[model samples]
Target chain A: MRVLIQLRPAPDVVAAVIEPGVRATAADVAGRLPGVVLDQAFAPVAVPRPVPASAYGDPLSLNQRVEFSYAPQDAAVLVRGEIADDELSTRSVLLPSARRDVAGVFADPVIHSTPTCGGDGPVGHWQDVARLLGAPEMTVEGHDGSGVTLAIVDSGINAAHVQAHLGREVIIDTERSWSPPGVGGTPGEYPVAHGTMCAFDALIAAPRATLLDIPVLLSPHNVAGLLSDAVAAYAHLRTVLEAMPAGSRSLVISNSWGLFSPGQDFPPGHPGNYSDNLAHPFNLIVASLDQAGADIVFSAGNCGRECPDRRCGFPDRPITGANSHPRVLSVGGVDTGLERVGYSSQGPGRLSDRKPDICAYTHFAGSEANGPGTPDTGTSAACPVAAGAVAAIRTRHPATEISPAQLRTLLHRTAEDRSTLGFDHDYGYGVINPPAVLESLGRHTRHAA
Target chain B: MVLLTVRLPPGATLADALARLELAEEDVDTAFGLVPIDPGTGLYAVRVAEEASHRAANTAGGPFSDPPIAPHGSQDPHDRHAPPSG
Candidate 1:
């Protein structure tokens, strides 16, 4: 019995990027030989057939039938049906080295620039933040971040940043672009300094954690993409992480990006809150990562004054913003003196839960270079600092696999609760006391050795 | 869980070496990625780095108690206005 297989048509939108190989473009069956189908093109769920992303890669040679079968159903059907000889294999579409960098959000050395808005500069506060983390006293000696790999998903890191240098080649800096060129060109555009700052914070915070700079958003260009493609890029990040050895410790994922009903172009849900719009890949991605034993840390969006409940803008309903997602270690901002940044997003997460899982000072950060105090704000710069601190804790308690919940609980337990009314939304888990956190978790071996 | 930067043969698939080394996919994913080192080198490469927890395992003693710098205080900052915007 000859079986007919239905394949996912290519995304039509990508056509603008590449030249269509004539097989599918031209008339008959004679020309369409080497064209095979990739399984991922179609999701189990229903999605309108998008304009097929242009078929990149060179054309299939005449008569060179590129055959592929969906292992999902093709295998079962082949066994059920009385079939002749059939070729079966996991299908992957031939793609152009079309891969580009996923920019990271940076702080400190990477930017050397300031927020158009406010805050203390990296140079201005570098000493202060480092001091807060117990720099000289902690052990200037490097431990190799020795074997640690912390993924920094933000604007994209500056490869030359001082923090990138501290650990040498430990930085996996990838740049993502906003509106990239047809073929892969310069990273979508130089990623804004955000991802770079995040990377710097993480590297300095953990010094020993190997840094993987995954650029999810490019700034000054391709900003919209940062929101849409984040989840997929994160999944792709998992594909990278899985390639590591087992018994890996301190598997940290840091995200310093966010949104709130950003605008019309955003998919369905608000980058900040939930919407009738598309559900962000963040929640889904975080839950999956948590299951895989990776700790995720994200920024509380900069939605301070525009409180959805008290005084939000139009359509400012409180949806589960980035900090609201469970399974993530959400962070808000504090200034150089460790005061909560007025504009930093504060929240009781998804279900009226207190958020900004913890707080980190973004306003006054120190630098590796001698620069003036250029102001900055937003949890974008704060999240990575907290992530780096987590790296330090994880580094110390190597044996204990602290679940996201436990880590949050531990932070709360060890936290020097500020307000008489502990756990308030304003400071969430209160300020980050790196020494106390380190002291609390104490020394332990991996797997209780 | 040491971070190793290994160079693959020309036209080598990083996935294959990663599989051979029995490296966890997470490490491969986090440690390595294909980047364009030189504009058109188009060569593929993989980076491998361990996590802090894993880094701790390799340590002879334990987590370093003596760090280079001292921890900063988490005291509350006094609220002040934006020094009068001109």
Candidate 2:
């Protein structure tokens, strides 16, 4: 066990350790101590003695008033060394009594940088994310989500709250926005919550895109909605897509909600299963929507191996159902520093092996939906951020011009590959590179022109 | 309630779906109606009670799982907006 030994060798030696120019080694101070293997490289440090400030104050307890004194006679020196693990307790108790000069022996525990967990503070602000995504350059280049329709299929959106945080007017297509069967609330007027945060993140790159508030998540059960509701919601969105002209259709659906447990689902191989079965009604609808030229993006859940969310119940391959569907872009989370957030789920997804198709900025200080100073966190936030990037590209290149399959290939090809070989489960094809995508689109546009 | 899918011609209604599946109105969630999964493929979905779903599954597509879903975020378990129990 590594430990710090406190010794009151002599006043002159204590003064020498405290002196700026003078150097005092462990051997120079203590001479020799038995059993402890002294660390010769570690310089001895002088520790201040605490003196009681009041007559009633106890010197041993710091709960009362006390003053730290650096007087040579009062001060003690601390030296680093290791002792046998078996004899640690014995030596710690006997060291001071064994040597008259030995004051105390204290533990020197190892420490490390704490990885950002679920409840931790934001890593950086949203503007830093805008910079990381090269949002300004994309906006300046005319890929600013004009005339595009971006749908947020989550709880419900509060346009006022989203507008306040974004510092801009939010365009809600009241005519197109739809709610589930029994869900009550007007389009863009629901309470501020998860859906609003998704709206705010998506508009970062595609501010001009019209938002379709599809609150499939709000149901009669209060905070919960059945998968059947999502199926019905997708059906409404299909009509919305069909209403648009085929040659100019541009609808980007951002889904930040998913199933967290297999308990509710039919077992994997069951005929009615939704997790790994593409034949399931919801999965089929997702495929139908993708086939109809809607750019769908889903969050790769918060069930990461290192520090998973408490609600994650999937024992393995947490990315399941439509969130793992091959047709959609499954987004994982990364902080503004470009490091994958510890809670961003890794892949080898059930529906598609190369899931988490790309990563995007998250865990940043944005939308005060959760509260002031809280980050827009989880792969939930990252999904819309990547969806926003796709919307930005769609501003100039409609789905008719660049098919969803073709666009997905471009994103994978141009991604900033994080691993030595091409792809890995952790980062998939790597972080979404908006600038590279824009550049590629520009090249295609010039060639077509 | 469980979900069941059926194929119908374009512009099919809940009445048309019920008549084709041979299910009565009481066993179906009328509010949910008949949702089109693929308009081009003439595919539609309906919500029915477990027993009705089993009977309809013979002709319709499923007695499929209707699992609950919630937003994926780092929220306090006791918070009002926490993800729903499975």
Candidate 3:
């Protein structure tokens, strides 16, 4: 019964609503109403405290933070009132509002992590991904992503392990990179292998690009912690990118994670719903990043098949949330046989008609420093592979003002069509054709000159 | 609510153990279905409706269903884009 009470207070009423006084008034009002028990009130702050690096240390972690509220509105107060469905409808009439200054009420929905590993037994090689995308030829032509940066936003990256696997110096900009502020471990230093595996996979395509490891998922103890922290991390990322030098090469953000099973009772407007609605904090942050010219990529998820592979049975609705955002490139997984993997999530994404903008190889092997084997596979593997390819092209055309939209167009136009026709749900436009994409970019460069 | 820890033999998948738990579609109620203790170690924390409690205990390892322990602690707490295995 968590509710967000949005306050619309005039200048004179603003103080009453913004201060703890409004909460007291609401509590008093709730006391009179039958079956209503006022639980807690959250005052609005102009600027939220930055999320701490460690999950347990942050006081605000457990409570809801007002990400965005309308102007002329004060703070949103959270309350728990036990009332029956029929009586709940009377809340608008019974709850204190005009004098107390509350505008709207909405539920605060909980979000969960979209739940990876591979090594040794059946190793997936980087060469397979490169060959699948025809990247070796491009790599030979010197488009190995020297100047660009690929930011891996995931649990945390094992920078040391990635460097060991590549057998060379790989730059991981810790200062420029972000994690929640107070977290003790450095990027890739923590035990999580997902980030490290992603970093290794991205390097396979763009070996020279610098890695920016932003570890947003800190609740190593709970899955809900992983899902909830993402929104805040994106907000922090927006701030960091906004402060960076404007003329520097735009970054490629690789996110190989998303919400898979949004339970039955989830609301349409809830952030966990992954709706295309622009108001969602996650979508807003993604839109901001796209406007800043960052190429954002996301994995489509792994719920394609029935019981054996996916825990959620069969996905009724495949893609949602940031993965469904039109601005970002949503990727699906294909195996070495150039066929869609049984577990690769399929879609007509929540927001867009055509989803999984493209496919890349899965079960692709890469080095792992923390675990026993090369545990990088799935669309998680595909996303970084696609990101690395994009970085290489950005490196080749460093001065070109290739916006996110333009890059998406280029990928769509140049992709090798594999499925039904022009664009299919499983393969999107087709398999990512790196050499062809670079060739298209080359033509654009020549034409512009 | 029945909490049981089922240990899987070598080469056994998490899905295999979950099937052994006999969780039906109607029986599935939580936000997440399975919480892995250590997939490699084949250990899991299975929470099922009380009716299925006896069946969970009947598995080979015998149900350590007294009070369920939390899943294994890993350096990584987040989900990835792919399935846990290749």
Name the top TM-score candidate: 2
Residues A215-323 of candidate 2 have per-residue lDDT tens digits of 9888885657899889988988988999999889999999998898898888999988999999999999999999999999999988887788777888999999999
Alpha-carbon shift of residue A20 in model 2 (angstroms): 21
Tens-digit per-residue lDDT, B1-86, candidate 3: 33345667655644665677665644532433343333345554444555665555557232221111110112331343224452
Superposed on all Cα atoms, the candidates' RMSDs to the truth, in angstroms, are: 27.4, 8.5, 25.8
* Candidate 2 regions with alpha-carbon error over 4 angstroms: A1-114, B77-86
Tens-digit lDDT track of model 1 for A279-360: 3334445566665567788776555652211112224323244446766777877766666665566566653376766787
Alpha-carbon deviation at A199 in model 3, angstroms: 0.6
Clashes of each: 109, 0, 15
Q: What is the TM-score of candidate 1?
A: 0.53
Candidate 2 local Cα displacement, residue A297, angstroms: 0.2
Better of 1 and 2 by lDDT: 2
Rank list by lDDT: 2, 3, 1
The A-chain TM-scores of all the candidates are: 0.60, 0.75, 0.68
The TM-score between candidate 3 and the true structure equals 0.59
Clashing pairs in 2: none
How does the DockQ of candidate 1 come out? 0.02
Scored by lDDT, model 3 comes in at 0.61
Best by DockQ: 2
TM-score of each: 0.53, 0.78, 0.59
